[model samples]
Target: MKKILLSSLLLLVCHIHYAQVISIIGSTSPAGNWSTDIDMATTDNITYTLTNVNLTTATDPGTTGLKFRQDHDWAVNWGSANFPMGTAVQNGANIMTQAGTYDITFNRSNGTYTFIPAAQPRVGIWGPAVDSQNGFGGPDVDMTTTDGILYTLSGFYFSSGSAYFRVNDNSTLTYGSVSFPTGTAVEQGPSIQVAGGEWFVTFNRSTGAYSFTYPSIGILGDATSVGWLNDDIDLITTDGFEYTLNDLVLTDGEVKFRKDNLWTTNWGSLGFPQATGIQDGPNIPVTAGTYDVVFQKSTGHYLFTNTLSNPEYSVANVKIHPNPSNAIWNLKHDTTIDAVTLFDASGKIIGNYAPNTTEFQLDGSNLSNGVYFIKINSGRDFSVQKIIRN
Candidate 1:
């Protein structure tokens, strides 16, 4: 019985020691000799904690802190020997780093601890131009070269040995385009990668024109045909090329076509006089069998040059009462009407009547919940009103 009691007492002591808590104390120095100490004490359920320390004296003594609670896998490893940096309590995954020497440290009581060494300085491509424009809300890098050439830096390194760098052509670099200067140096740290090497600094130039390519072309018509008729015909060059048209005038004789910003073509005569209203033009005459069609422009109030064959319906005076009607709808129009038609949403005629009186009331109560259009035709004029059936 005594032996069993002694064994139970030893087990209790081991359990108490297994649940230990650790605290870190550290100080920052401008001379670059910063140091930290970890202290451990017995606890009930507390596991581990993590904190981040900044070496650069930029803000708040250059020290930023991060903590992790209840961490089961807590271990420390040497991050860099030259920089004398150490990482603590990485739970999972292998530690990755760039070129340079590093040391590792690990400690655990009830659980196993593992230390993984990694390199330092994590070399990568850094863009000075992108960083500078970040504050101004501009493009990461601007291509000001007339040839439309752009350059970006690319390269990789493991920590900080001799860094390698190369220049990548983001835009086609050609002759006469602005290029990056050769032999540029870059710095990488924290989360940044700097470019290095002579070629990485310079940009390649291109010798191409600096204009945007537009696939569609536009054409304008003379003032007389300028109305609706102007939109009827599309213009194209004789060689089947597309050209934009502009600066049209309404003269007594014909409409002329111009190329680029100069070189006017012979007057393209129209069949009808400018005074006569505009109507849709006939198909273009075929000389070479086919031609590219350009965009149409407004010459006048109408879109074409030909006069409308049917007489237009005009509404003179119209009236509606109890406009915000809940059931019945009443409509009145001037002149004797020939026919009155009501149309639904699909443009289908729902009701028709032979015109007699000037006033008519539509029994909207029978209509479903929706909107309807009423068309009234009188001799040469017609009027339409929107009626709600709610």
Candidate 2:
């Protein structure tokens, strides 16, 4: 009987120590701004969980403070004196953390807790021999993220082959292979076979939403000569990321730039005629005239203006034709005087000419079939134009 009584007392003591109810409190809450307790859910007697707990810091959203307490009381709590990300503490200061979704676990038996950053939604592309720019056999091309959640990547050239999305750079953390419709969750199933094309892609990791946009970006609408036709005047990539649509004739009509020649994903600006810049905000209005438009994708800074007038924005009046020229090329301009210089693709000076006249012929039969730049210094105003010689 004495032995039985001793065992009963020991059991009571163990229950009191290991089975006490624990809760979480913090500045950004479910914790009532640290004034109240948010009880943690428990599955086993020794394990507790608080899933999807939102947290933030005191001064900055990226930093956070939090702690664990017992029975909605602060007299007994767990925190860290060192305040490490995953370090456990008892009767200590609040734990420091960054703003993110977390799955926090506390083990009563060991006085241990795990503060894990939840698996974030991310999407990347990995393929088998897609192209040289994105070669197959592993290292995937990651999309750029602005908000750390949604991501986008554009200007990808893919051959007829298969690819898939992954949560991370790791090939193991991948989604399903089948070509999911836009907004559908990409599962970790099979590789998606794609036809040969240049593409744009976007992904939302949170909802498994993914989409592949075709390379159908062009100038269209009644403002343009095409007027909603499939033959949209395509923009050429000048600096890879930035694009240029040259010599577009628009009547007095509304115009916009769009992708896939669709109403969706269109860009324009109500703030038109601003000498400062253009952006992808509202529909742009145009007066009748021919113009060259430049769009900087990374900055959304664009400009549409008279090609010849704005030397800063347009190609120079000096014209080089048969641009994809062969051995012989013609250079013509109304203004004359000063030096003309030719540069290779790498900006290396190839030839210098002191023509001192308006018209000149460039003998380039010796040049290769690639891109070049011609810098014309007409004594007063100078401009650089790209030349492609075949």
Candidate 3:
């Protein structure tokens, strides 16, 4: 009877030890040596937390930050190279942390941990367009965090207006830029004048690097007239939400619609003539024929009609303003441009440019120009525009 009673007592002690065994240890993690254990507090035993834990010293952020162990022993432990927040595993690498006082939370159930800095605040966007969707004077559209440095908000419909990021959602601390699509964030800066559309937005609180995705959808693939080039058959958007192309000639191949000619977001499907597409879907099939295509942006629905007869939409649309100018001339295209070369009527190369922009401003005051052929290169295709300077 005594033997069974002693065995039961041992089991109870083991259960108690297992239930109360989670602590941190490291260099400058409030501990100069690894021989000691600093315990954590837990109410449910599933989530362990340690508040106001200093993970580094004042002079330097030590290379090795901290790791979690159970019962002051390494028999069951969790560690990871990722810091601020990450899922740790048994026998993993050491967690490297930055210099700051943090309230740390570690999930005993999933091995996920988060180190939230005390000094850093939340970042969010505020504007009329955001207010329309998120509601006026409501909570700002909050950007989420992983490492707590770069914050992001995706697929947000920000109507063309002004927007900016404010610290803690209501603080006077602000980060803004001059324009949309791409720019660096500036404190106490002017409002960001958006191009007005739905886009993926990102902002880095540390470096102030931020960008909004451009809203341009184009057709690509071997089935396109341009064929496997980085170039796209630019579409026309009368409503800014749907794109269309008239007189497009395609051979028997496959195609897809990508945003801004980038594969970051794309649509494809099996059905032709009309169908709905999904992101990273299968390539869309095509037959040898001329087609008029229409695509819905918000939804992936598309339609193709081969009955229309109009100009072929296989070439880049370029406009040369003030072709006959004294000093300055402007060039623009529907798509991203690569290079521009100037050739005299005598078939001699007069000027060469590699300005990768939608618009190129040319100066012809130095040239005694009677007639010059300007070649604009987009992807593998090229367009020759005329310039007359008298």
Highest-scoring model, lDDT: 3
Best by TM-score: 2
lDDT of candidate 1 over 1-390, digit per residue (tens):
999999999999888766545433322211222243443333344334232222221122224221121322234421111123233343322222222222222233333222223322221132343333332132233322211233323221112112122123221211222212223233211222322211112233222222211112233333335432233233432221222233333333323332221222212323222111123333122221112222221111111122223324334466777665777767676666677777764445788988577777766676787766666666644445567766
Model 3 scores a TM of: 0.38
The lDDT for every candidate, in the order shown, is: 0.35, 0.66, 0.76
lDDT per residue for candidate 2 within 224-334, as digits (tens), equals 878764457878773333467768888888777775455545677764543222344566777877787765333334567675564442235778777778777788776
The CA-based lDDT of model 1 is what?
A: 0.35
Comparing 2 with 3 on TM-score, the higher-scoring candidate is 2
lDDT of 2 at 170: 74
Supply candidate 3's per-residue lDDT for 128: 63
TM-score of every candidate: 0.24, 0.41, 0.38
Candidate 3 lDDT tens digits, 6-44: 999999888776685799887757775667789999987
Which ranges of candidate 3 are over 4 A from the true structure?
1-120, 132-139, 215-275, 278-390
